[model samples]
Target chain A: MFETLSNVFTDNPLIVSFAIIGITMYIAYKLSDKLTRGRIHGSAIAIILGLVLAYLGGVLTGGEKGLSDISIFAGIGLMGGGMLRDFAIVATAFGASFDEIKKAGMSGVSALFIGVLLSYVVGVAVALSFGYTDAVSLTTIGGGTATYIVGPVTGAAIGASSEVITISIAAGLVKSILTMIGTPFVAKYIGLNNPRSAMVYGGLMGTTSGVAGGLAATDPKLVPYGAVTATFYTGLGCLMVPSVLFLMTRAIFG
Target chain B: MVIFGVALLAICMLIGIFFGEILGLFLGVEANVGGVGIAMIMLVLIVDYLKKRGKLSLPAQDGLGFWSAMYIPIVIAMSANQNVAGALDGGPLAIMAGVAAALIGWLFVPLLSKGGLQTEETVEENTFIGGENKNVRNIK
Candidate 1:
């Protein structure tokens, strides 16, 4: 019976992939509700678990594609590939209304630029401190600070080393985790209860998941507002990091 | 109704992807140029227009909303999972970069919040950050 079930999953990898993700999400949500008292979002927990599984997959398969390297878990790669990623991002934008966005005004717009620039500079500084002197390495890492997506996108655009690109991604992930854990603790002190404030905070924070999760814990009502601007932040980072920021880094380091 | 909304989404995504490809070609980049962002803007504008023109019913709007919300968590998870294997093997510099970025970002929060908290005297928006106010319920 066990062999037959295992063979079934191996034959139909996509179904197994869905089952794994579904189970992971269920457990993550349960953990969030019970262990974290819903302070941490289930999505965050699921991502961490996914990463762990990916790591284990790499160890088990001795391959670079993580779980997808294993024949039975090959479907995970397609499910989490770039096409669905872009689709999901576009879909999320459907809920945003123009009038609500207009309410944020100049302050919110400026926050996006400020947030991207601040994180980029900090990322560059860190890269330099770690003894990286190349323009591609510095810019890619700096872009990662803007957001994980930005980091890899910038690296691929500018032909950065894979190692540098990975480091940049790591930087972005660290930022995301910190943002997730820290937002609720500091929400009160920052006056993050209002829509306008949430918008501004989202712009400044930039990581959609972190800002959204943090705000969800702080105030469910504020999640939409923060998410809107954080979405903008990601788009803006993608735009600037590879072109203008990469040029600046090249000029300075080269 | 769901099919119509999905069709609209598909149209927007197609146009956005086309435009992104053009943008990427023009910029000499090898990847898609913000196709998702473009598609999102197109969807937003289209949906809002439909809403104002009375072309969209409440149920359809709700359906669109449901898909968007459902898609978001999935998107978040997918993006978070990207490149973790590479990062883990990138050695100590990668780990250091990650740690430094998080630490600095956390520390910088105070300075960013200073601008927000200092202006609490504004009478226009009565809602404060920390404590619950009745007005909080008014936000969508």
Candidate 2:
């Protein structure tokens, strides 16, 4: 019976992958509720757990792609691929009513541009301080400050070195983790208790997972509102960073 | 109803992917254009329109809700698989740039959060019908 069950899971990798994720999420949420008193979002804990598992998988298998390196966990790679990632992102809009969006008004609209430009400028300045003068590298790293998705997307578009692209991703990831952990701590201080404020905050932050996780921890009601604008922030970043931002960086540095 | 909602979502996704490809071609980028974003917009508009018209049932709305929130944890996990190890090897400068962005971005929170009250109606609405009483579970 044990051999047959193992064979079943091994044959249907996706099922086992789902089972692992399900169990992990259950434990993560339970820990969040009990240990942190729901201060740290379950999603955040789950992500950390996933990363740790991936690291261990890499060490044990001596392969890249982490857990997917193990044959049984291969489904994780597909499940987390661009297709589902994009789908999940897009699905966020379903909960966002246009009427509620209009309620956010012009402040929400400007927040997106302000957030992107601000992050990009900071990213460029930091890159410069670190002695990177090339236009491609500067723009890519700057885009990373905008969001993790934007970082890799912009880097690939501008043909940055793999090392630089990886750095850009790291920069974005750092921003994401910070946003995830910090939002709850600062929610009360920033008055992020309402949907409108959440929408504006999301626009300013631009990291979907961070905003969602942060808002989930702060107030689950705010997650959809924040996720909506964060999604827009990503689309806007992808649209602008490679074109307008890249040109500006080149004109300045080259 | 659930099946119908799922079908709608799939259709919107396909169209969004197609539109994104066209957009990428036009922009001369190798990446897919805002396919997911566009699809999401379409789904929202269509689903809401149907809901407002009383065509969508409660069960269908619930089904959409379940699917929408289902993948979030998985997505978060997938994102962790990014080439963080490679980025760490990009030297101290790269690490500094990343750390600086995160810190500076955090600083912006205070400044960005002060957008202020827009209209009297919104404040009233939030206090009366919004605020803590408005649950995320009932968003659909």
Best by DockQ: 2
* TM-scores of chain A across candidates: 0.70, 0.81
lDDT of 1 by residue, A151-235 (tens): 9988888899887787787778667655765676677666775556777787787887677556644654556556666766766
lDDT of 2 by residue, B90-115 (tens): 46655666566555645665566564
How does residue B112 of candidate 1 score in lDDT?
Answer: 50
Number of the top-ranking candidate, with lDDT as the measure: 2
lDDT of each: 0.66, 0.69
lDDT of 2 at B116: 48
lDDT of 2 by residue, A1-254 (tens): 98887688678876777778888878888888889887676766776677677667667676656677777677777666566666665555666556666677466677788888988998899888888999999999899878777888998888999887877877776677567656777776767766677777877888776776666556554665676677667777888899999998999999
TM values, all candidates: 0.73, 0.81
Candidate 1 residues lying further than 4 Å off, grouped into runs, are A1-4, A10-14, A62-69, A134-136, A147-166, A169-254, B26-33, B72-80, B103-140
Give the per-residue Cα lDDT of candidate 1 at A45.
69
Query: What DockQ do the predictions score, one after another?
Result: 0.26, 0.34
TM-score of 2: 0.81
Clashes of each: 1, 0
